[model samples]
Target: MIATPYLLYLGHSNDEIGIKTSRGLAVFRPDICVGEFRHDDCGLTLGLPRLDFAAARDAGARTLVLGIANAGGRLGNDLVEDALAAMEAGLDIASGLHQRLKDEPRLVAAAARLGRTLHDVRDPRPDIPVGTGRRRAGKRLLTVGTDCSVGKMYTTLCLARALQARGVKADFRATGQTGILIAGDGVPLDAVVADFISGAIEQISPDRTDGGWDLIEGQGSLFHPSFAGVSTGLLHGAQPDALVLCHDPMRRTMRGLPHYQPPRLDDCLEANLRAARLTNPQVRAVGIALNTSAMDAAQATDLCARTADMFGLPCSDPYRMGVDAMVDLLLAMDAPAATETI
Candidate 1:
């Protein structure tokens, strides 16, 4: 008898994947030979009969699709390889199933529930600033990721406070209005942006003799679902003069052990540059904040030096360099064109 071919949907979160299956979405667990489908958001993995591609084909399954998140470019190569291996083993699977199958009602419902739960739990909408246009005055913006749980918010909060302490007028704003604000307990994104813009205008009012800068921080990866409006919204609304990319430097291991290693300086620089160019072509300079998860002071210093040289931006240890240094560095960088008009 010919082996049966099956479709597999792969994702990172076990609970989330299980919910997808409950909503009639075809999903298979690599550990089990069964396929599962479901229709609810409650977190549970149910096993279905092992998929037989021959049977599926006999059942008129014209195409097999596999979906995955974080599968683009260099990041998702492993998922692609694994899916290919399953196909080679006669599973008759499709590649990048998540995108292909996302249109299904069950999948859409599950996503909606997840979004609502997140919004209800964190009330992210309240953080969005009200105004839709660029600020009328010069401001400094700082962006940080909301994912990785690597202390991005903590660093951002610290920097904001430090900047204030140094008599620099800056306001903290979430990168994207969706997930970052939803994950927090503060004002919505629109309100925050409005307040920040108002603050900028006040600081640089035409009647005033001196003007101040505005600081905005971003949240989540550029491609993260929760970060939908971050890049474009920030550029269109806040018009940041400079960008500060904060990242954790702990080497991610397959075994989940935190290991100390040289940072991916080139990759970070290129990624930030690409993000800035894609969002707003006017971003003038880039600064980096490195989080030392397990590195010693000497290692952190060396890493900082190497990163600065490679990226042509100041690199500093968030723990050691302090927010004052960061603010000073940002002010010294040339302002972007958007700032000139304000």
Candidate 2:
């Protein structure tokens, strides 16, 4: 595992979504995060103490987490220099970019000379087997979305916590970099080879008989042309018995692709269910989770109510509003049908 007590490196990020890795860690694993490191011109903050490499190390940080998520996922020359400096200040380096830190000659040489570790969190293990498609023993719920960055991680996390609070055994299975950092373990499905993506997910979440739930975090949308393959692989591998559709109503178009419009909620849900049925024919949608960050309190509440009525399923903003209704519905699934199945 990458060392903790992290000093999150934000670099010079100005886009809020681009800094999702740092934001996720700060919100979900705050105790392990020591401080934030950014250029003077950077305006983002995680509400943590600001410190340089030396100060962060002195404050007991063991690693510097490169927490930026740019479009290309490339490790720029400036970032490489910062990583070298962090190692000099007695800290290891960890990254989840598409570019591997271990492959960078400069970073590799510095790490070896300094006796520091380079954690390429996005790197997949080599021994993953092809998906067997056999039924597993535990209950699972996957959070799907209408588009990317619509809070699938957040919804899964909330449901896991809520289930645990109700005296049920539950675990959050991370699938992406942000989720991986938050849960401390997961397969970076997006980084895995196309043929092994499903296999990687199967390895990440295997059979269990605790009568509990494995809340598997999701990746891209089935409608997103850029990431549909990853999403389909995750869907089949999860074999989820239930699903929670996540959406961001404020987006008029798919994230990063303004040319393509977001799919209608009905269309997105049906498409995901059909794809998921390839593994678990009984898989049903449990609820709807919305990222209502753009809405006021009243608007969020009203939208949730209308959505619940529209779909005949419990709907709520998993962050601003508690997912108690969804959790309750999930637990009561053994009873008669509370909602329609696909």
The list of candidate 1 runs beyond 4 A from truth reads: 1-121, 124-135, 145-147, 174-210, 223-236, 251-268, 274-280, 333-342
lDDT of 1 by residue, 212-232 (tens): 555554544443344434433
- What does the lDDT read for residue 316 in candidate 2? 98
Which 10 consecutive positions of candidate 2 have the poorest summed lDDT? Answer: 333-342
Tens digit of per-residue lDDT, candidate 2, span 144-175: 99999999999999999899999999999999
Q: lDDT (0-100) at residue 307 of candidate 1? A: 79
Clashes of each: 42, 0
Overall local distance difference test of candidate 1: 0.44
Q: Tell me the deviation in Å of residue 255 in model 2.
A: 2.7
Cand. 2 Cα-lDDT: 0.89
